[model samples]
Target: MERFWKPLLHFGYQQAMSCLFPVIIFVSLAITKVIDVPHLPDYDLLFIICLATQYVMYRSGMESKDELKVICLFHLIGIALEVYKVHHGSWSYPQDGWTKLFGVPLYSGFMYASVASYLCQAWRRLDVTLVGWPKPVWTVPLGAAIYLNFMTHHYVYDIRWVLTALLFIIFFRTVVTYKVLSVTRRMPLAVSFFLIGWFIWLAENIATYLGAWQYPNQREAWTAVSWGKLSSWFLLVIVSFIIVAQLKHVKERREEVPFRASRDSGQEAKRQA
Candidate 1:
């Protein structure tokens, strides 16, 4: 029973962390729509939700100060992309409020913050570690290029496929080692990116269904978001991974000499298994 319950509890925690933002969106939308606060804007409602979400996180001690800083940075980064994407006609917020920044509602940033929160929570909870982390020379530039391509593709040719190939080259052999219960599990880093991206895409559909943002095609009628966005989310996963990597570096530095040495030795022993 102890062995069975350990993995179950870990899984429950992971799901809770991953669903935190989406659940907030879902419940907030339901409540706001059901109750009438005359003149309370959707954007403002979302802002309150964001604050409440952060407060709950801190009070629960689920996120540390360093993790909060990373989450806030991701919020800003996400907003920058939102501003550009909304301006470029990639997507539109079909609502109005004082919280709007050049057309994007500030609450939009929390969506990205949620991603950071999820990664941070999972890392700590799962005792996650990386093997074969590519050097910054390769990863930093690749992350920058992937982010830049999202904006530049409007004027320049879309190099997403090329970037995707480069991402594979960098991470295909890299493995993510995470523990669940008494056992450790490993998977290729790239595969985790795709799995995460697919889930985010699913969550995006729910967010849109709740009217968080509307793609051009979605403006007239609600439909499933384009499957192509999976690729975009996959690249965004890389960006999220990079940010988490940097944060983890601070934690890793204290443990790397002993930890990595053992982890690497273990990898070698298991190479035949």
Candidate 2:
């Protein structure tokens, strides 16, 4: 029993560490909602807090520069989505802030960044690797289509379900291998996506309650987000995973290239001698 519980405890600890960014974001949201900070709007304050936390994480070596880049990319992607969604009445930021852009707070992007941060952190902490990953030709296009559908669905027909079906086809054989403590574990890539998406949905509930943003129905009172949004989060998670996976693959290949060059040069010198 001790043996069984030990790995579980370690896994939990690693997961908590992996969630540092998101946990901070959520805590910031709750505190700002309840505590009145004089002259500092809640949204703007949250933004400042996020920036400081990110810098500290990088300076302390908790997050690498590359991970920070990924988080920034997600931040921009999120801001664009927020702008569009707010315009279309999908959700609204009900608070006032100087950082508002087109009625959406600039700090809102950090919510999306938090998701990317979690994925990067968990990947590193768990020593995650993918087996049977599909080619980028398949993944890149799929991720693009998924993100496009998020906006295009409002104007044209929503093909999210179709894209999801394609996800099943593309990653059908992929497996995620991860290490926790002294044990190694494997999970189907699709299952991992669903699990992450479900947890994000749970987090969304807490975030919404703390006035992160509100759906049409949530404007007047706090309520659970629709279950339908789970599918949206699931697709978003795939996009995030694909981007990270491709970047990690490219980084590994680049690192390997220099090592291979040195080895080949040494072999040539030996042959010449």
Candidate 3:
């Protein structure tokens, strides 16, 4: 019983801490309708939430300087996609505010930052390591291709399925090793991708339900996001992971314990000879 509860408590705590930003935003938005802040725009309120969230993370040491950099990078990437998507009618922000950037609320980027925050937090909390992770030569180009497809797919042939297949090729052999309490466990990288994507999809539903953004069909009324979006989120998860990996986690083979020291020993012997 202690063994089971220990791991469960660890998982629950990490998940809750990682979700801090999104929950704050969601609750703030829900309350905005009931409480009137005189002359405050909804988008501005969201902007404030974004700022407050970052401040909280920084002050509480929830995010390190490097992690903050990664989160900012995610925000930039997310905003770039948001600009294009909003312009192309992929989605729309119905409310107006001074902080709008080419029709996207400044706070929209926080959504992506939240993902980065979760990745960074989970890595530290779970003591995660990547085994059999593909070489950077393999993952870097694949990540770029995935990001490109998100843009080109709008005008050209949608090659998302092709990219998805390549993701499996690159990552199928990869395992994510993590510790929970006293136990060490491992899971396939692809499984983690799908699971995170599914949870993000669930979160997306809640965000839309909170009026974070509206799809064309949703302009009239709220509806469930399409199931097909799971695939997109799956792909996006890879993109997020690649960026976080490049900046922080996603250890290579040589970075693992015994091998890391062995390689150093071999190098010393070579130098002596």
TM-score per candidate, chains pooled: 0.88, 0.98, 0.89
Candidates, ranked, lDDT: 2, 3, 1
Model 2, span 1-273: residue lDDT tens: 988898889989999999999999999998997899999999999999999999999999999999999999999999999999999999999898999999899888988998999999999999999999999999999999999999988889999989989999999999999997856899999999999999999999999999999899987788899999999999999998999899999999999999999999999999999
Model 3 weakest lDDT span, ten residues long: 246-255
Q: Could you arrange the candidates by TM-score from highest to lowest?
A: 2, 3, 1
**How well does candidate 1 score on lDDT at residue 144?**
91
Question: Please, what is the whole-model Cα lDDT of each candidate in the order they appear?
Answer: 0.86, 0.94, 0.87
Each prediction's total of clashing residue pairs, residues at least 3 apart in sequence or on different chains, is 0, 0, 0
List the RMSD of every prediction in angstroms: 7.1, 0.8, 3.8
**Tens digits of lDDT, candidate 1, 131-214:** 999888899899999999999999999999999999999887789999877588899999999998999999889888878888
lDDT digits (tens) for residues 59-138 of candidate 3: 88988887888889999999999999999999999987899999999999999888888898888878888889787899
Q: Give the TM-score of candidate 2.
A: 0.98
